[model samples]
Target: MSLFNVFDISGTAMSAQSVRLNTTASNLSNANSVSSSIDQTYRARHPVFAAEMNRATANMDDKASVGVKVLGVVESDKPLTVEYNPNHPMADKDGYIYKPNVNVMEEMANMISASRSYQTNIQIADSAKKMLSRTLRLGQ
Candidate 1:
């Protein structure tokens, strides 16, 4: 793979991580939301990613770097939390309120992981830039 390909790989990775962070944020924001029924409750959303092969390098002898691509965001299939709150205004006829399936601790962990991955990609791009600059200086 060419040294320039590092930038493209890192850029794609950063973009994917940004989406992940955003989804995590959205899930956390709605963690406390209550609904009268399961259909009205929010489901935790997660970003799906897939590695895309570099077409340019596919036919070449050298292995090409794979870029990250976001497949899409999917809602968690886990069951939502059902709480009994007779006094709650939004409670159903059975005095049950529906809560989102989001786990606060899990979302926080996901946020930290996504942020760190994003930072790692930035560092990779910065390192590639420095390497390229040093290579140019060698001709001076």
Candidate 2:
């Protein structure tokens, strides 16, 4: 892969991580939200990513450089939490309230991971820029 491709790779990685962070934030924001029914409760959402190989790299037998692509965001299939709260205004007729499936601890971990990934990608791009600048200086 060309040195310039590093920027593209890092850019895509940053974008993907941004989406991940956004989803994690959204999940955390709604973590405590309650609904009258399970169907109305918010489910934790996560971004799905896929590696996109450059067309030129397809035929190469060596390691292929790839960028990231967000396939989509998917809601967790895990069941929502059902709590018995007879006094709650949103409680159902059965004296139960449904909470979002989002887990605060898990969302915090995901946020940290996404932040680190974004930082790593920034470092990669910075290194690539430095290498490119030094290479150009050599010709002067």
Candidate 3:
């Protein structure tokens, strides 16, 4: 891998983390949303990630992983929260309201993790910049 590939890898990683953070934020924002029917209830959304690969050389045996790739966003399959709140304005004919499957604590943790990951990537890019600058200075 080339030394400059570091920036590409870290940049893609940061983009993936941004997607993660966005999905986490959307999940958190809809965490409290209620619906009168199961079909109308919101579900927690999560991002799917995969590693992007590149052909390092003409040699068939040589391959290099370039960076992170976002496969897609998917909704959690976990069951939604069902509450027996007949008094609630959104209650259905069965007097039950449906809440999103999003867990606030889990979403909060995801937010923190994504943020830290983004920050780490930024630090990595900064380090690479500093290294390149020092190399240029050495040539001066």
Candidate 4:
């Protein structure tokens, strides 16, 4: 792999982590939201990622590097939280209020992890840049 490829890989990883962070933030924002029905309640969303790769033909076998690819964002299928709150204005006719299935702690953790991953990618790109710079200096 070339030094330039490192930047591309890290850039794609950072983009993927950014999407993860955004989803985590969205989930956290809707964590306390209440609704009268389960369908109307917010659900935690997560981004799916896949490892992109390129394989050479049989005539000339060579491995090609591909960056990270985002599959899609998916909503959590877990059960929504149900609570009996007769006094709540948004309560259903049965005096039940529905809350999002999002877990605040879990979302927070995801945010932290995503942030760290992004930081790591930045560091990787920086290191690659430094290496390339030093290599150029070697010729001078």
Runs off by more than 4 Å, candidate 4: 54-62
Per-residue lDDT of candidate 2, residues 54-75 (tens digit): 5436847755568899999999
**Cα lDDT listed for each candidate:** 0.94, 0.92, 0.90, 0.90
**Candidate 3 similarity to native, TM-score:** 0.92
Question: How many steric overlaps are in each model, in order?
Answer: 0, 0, 0, 0
- Error (Å) of candidate 1 at residue 43 is 0.3
Q: Give the winner by TM-score: 1 or 4.
A: 1
Full-model lDDT, candidate 2: 0.92
Error of 4 at 121 (Å): 0.4
Clashing pairs in 1: none
Q: Report the candidate with higher lDDT, 1 versus 2.
A: 1
Give candidates' CA RMSD values in order.
1.6, 2.0, 2.1, 2.1
Ranking by lDDT: 1, 2, 3, 4
Model 3, 119: alpha-carbon shift in Å?
0.4
- What is the C-alpha local distance difference test score of candidate 4? 0.90
Query: How does candidate 1 fare on TM-score?
Result: 0.94
Overall local distance difference test of candidate 3: 0.90
Q: Model 3, 15-46: lDDT tens per residue? A: 99999999999999999999999999999999
State the displacement of the C-alpha of residue 34, model 3, in Å, after optimal TM-score superposition: 0.4
